[model samples]
Target: MIFEGYHPLDKTMFQVMDEEGNIIKPEYMPDISKEQMMEMYQLMIQTREADLKALMYQRQGRMLTYAPNIGQEAAQVGSAFPLKKEDWMVPAFRELGAWLTRGAKLEMIYLYWYGNEFGSYMPEDLKILPVSVPIASHLNHAAGIAWASKLQGKDEVTITYFGDGATSQGDFHEAMNWAGVYQVPVVFLCQNNQFAISVPRGIQTSSETIAQKALAYGMPGILVDGNDIFAMYAAVKEAFDRARRGEGPTLIEAFTYRIGAHTTSDDPKRYRSDEEVEKWKKKDPIDRMKKYLMSQGILTEEENEKIIEKAGKIAEEAFKYVEASGDTVLEDIFKYHYKEMTPQLTEQLAEYKAYLMERGEA
Candidate 1:
């Protein structure tokens, strides 16, 4: 007999830590060691530094366009920590913290922003997919990969990242349907960072909470305080555990905000007011995490300085490495496609080489 208890559809937001970094639900906290907490803090610091450096690179015309992940560090880093090495991460473009936590090198990410295709080429052992720029396109791909893992009887789960805006895409629903029917091992992380390039979350959907939509797809959905790392980590770990137990998929709506412009080209002030930005800024993920660490005596002021310094050094080294590598060969792009080059590609390559040679630029 099913008891009609409290439904999560009642818009209950799960939060472990408050904006002031106080633990509000100690009983609900995950079993994260002090070492794990320190690591999470470091990842958040590194992410913020990387974002700032990328912005500078863009301003100086040293890099291509970038999508900043300034305020959502806790949401990305916390959720990424629980995955085993064999687990797959099919990521959207704005997942710098998550990628870094999953062992991706800063140099590779920098190369990606410099328009180097080699940047997105992750090592085979990492099990992370290349950044998907088209919104929600990889939704079904994550399901397909997880489904294959299930068929093979491998104990692996696939976790994918997307924005709240992606819920509008038909691919999202299709992926949900597949996961629901097959009971595949996959976790859907929707970072609801307020705006999807100027469109507010309220305008994105009529549902009171994005998590509630999971009911229609026959899955469990949890709305988490994205700025609270503790809550974020706990929710994601539980979801993955459920999937590994053959309980099917989960949808996590991380309630956070994007502190910066959507991309380098965007001007957020054109739509949202400065006051709203200031409000979210006060709840900055990194700051809250720092407060929690300090309160627990796990992080000292000296140690905090070192973490920030190390992160800055890493970003600096990445920028230097990418700049020193020089531009990729214009013709090299044609090589990775096919061993036996197509007739049209061969013709184009030959034409381009001839043109370059004529101009003494080959």
Candidate 2:
């Protein structure tokens, strides 16, 4: 595992599977049951379908906003699947696959996108935090949580997910510095999807790789081919294992691509070319996994069709649930904004209700 040359980051892009669906290192494959592998594949399909359906909902003005993870399935699923139920997962905006894999309800995800804050609520047993829309702000929170867990002697690791753009944030550096100092049991997984909206990775930082930034924080950093699910799983699993063993945090840079716009509001076509998108499409994480499964005779054409059909049905059902949930109640915002409302806020709420009543819209 030695990286060589002037910039070791340039030579550390680890890949388990080649572009043509061939396994470059059979030994590096993730250690999971065949059934688990199949489930992961199905989840990847479901994630893509859900993203597409959400885009449709946005187009129809049924959803407020969405950050799609269309092409980064392997990076999300691979890292999430290895976590124990007791481990904590803190996600940035575009971690639908990780959230879903960690027991988030599809309906709740849709509801959140449709402007209802309740969708952010997770079950008491699930250790997933609400999605943070701000870039890398949650990194510090994750570090704090991990530090607290360490102090309490909790046998759990905290993993935080963010995009390549997040690496440029001051919060990222601060979190990494604190985590290193305290030896917090946290794993920072950065999904480097090449671009942060219109700004490309090159312009974001002078560093050769986001993973290399970890060295300054006194933590091990590994760069993996994010499109290769096997590599991602191996990298993350090892990182978390090390964390749970009282090792300090590890920074993993999943070098992948974003094949879609930053969000429904963004038009990536304005900055990136179709050719670049197509190039990444050929190296699609999901497609490569499916091809591998087929090569092993574990996935047949009939089975693939059934998986796609099931995913579509799930997406449709989630969409319907959100639609039926209706619009967000305007007054609920005031109630949830604070534990106790100030007199001024209470007066404003009363005035708003009165206005609605006068208009017969309440």
Candidate 3:
């Protein structure tokens, strides 16, 4: 496809569905069964509910710091579904749904937020890297992995998720340039939620759109309705397929809204108006999918209630597991640094342990 113009604003943004619960683009519809589509919608709803509950737990001091993925469930879950088992996924802080869809356990996610180092540890078989808090730094890691996979002749692609704010970072640009030059198998998924903390997307950059940045890298850049599950699934599947076919990288900008605080520590009311929040609520991804499902007679009120109840139960179980897991040990900080603790780390651990012992807190 020949893309005209240099900005996503001037190009055609692909979308399969509309906000009014209509599949406007029949040709772009996925080949998945109706049952599977309903299942995906159910899972996305469950994830959003779970994420909201986790935020409540953080506010009540029952859980650690939380990042709410309230409005981005479809973008996260749908994009994650097309990933292969062997492919690598590197996530930013706001990707709970993506991580869950990629096989991360709820308990581990809760534990990680509760300050447990082990929570960052993913099973080697899962091929998911640790959750990165340093914003765009993980883009470099993803690029490196893809470069190595290409060199090894492995049919693997790396997908990394970052926010619109992270797009302005030096590391993000560097990784894009390197990936483009090498033609590495990587997908740069940017969820442009219109804000980087209190800074709105308008103030973040004067660029026409985040997706347009990919033009400089010589890769296909797609803009899609992030709230529309069908659009997300189609865009990501196409990008993944191209990568597998050795066509190199693609950049996808999922246009959506945050609809919540940046984190439990943040208060959006300080910067954004309640009116804006209410406006986005009407365009909620879960509600859109629910409407579509109900129109198909695949989802009913009772089914929706049951799914919410089950998600609550699962979240409660995760909280219980995290609480029963106990606090992290002081020595654990030093243990995971290396296969074996170095002599300097050993001395520090011993000194810290001695101080705790003297205070009867070890």
Alpha-carbon lDDT, every model = 0.91, 0.88, 0.87
Q: Write candidate 2's Cα lDDT for 248-344 as tens digits.
A: 8999889999998998889998998999999899999998999989998889989999999989899999889889975788877787667798788
Report the candidate with higher lDDT, 1 versus 2: 1
Identify the leading candidate in terms of lDDT. Answer: 1
State, as a TM-score between 0 and 1, how close model 1 is to the true structure: 0.96
Candidate 2 stretches greater than 4 Å from native: 1-10, 339-344, 358-360
Order of all candidates by lDDT, from best down to worst?
Answer: 1, 2, 3
Clashing pairs in 2: none
- lDDT tens per residue, model 1, 1-362: 00012144867788889999899988777898999899999999999999999999999999999999999999999999999999999999999999999999999999988988788889999999998999999999999999999999999999999999999999999999999999999999999998999999989999999888888888888888999999889888988999999989998899999999999999999989999999999999988988989999999999999999999999999999999994787866876467778999989999999998999988
Give candidates' CA RMSD values in order: 2.2, 2.0, 1.7
The positional error of residue 265 in candidate 2, measured at the CA in angstroms, is 1.0
How far out, in Å, is residue 331 in model 2? Answer: 2.3
Name the runs in model 1 displaced over 4 angstroms.
1-7, 338-340, 358-360
Clashes of each: 0, 0, 0
Q: What is the lDDT of residue 240 in candidate 1?
A: 91
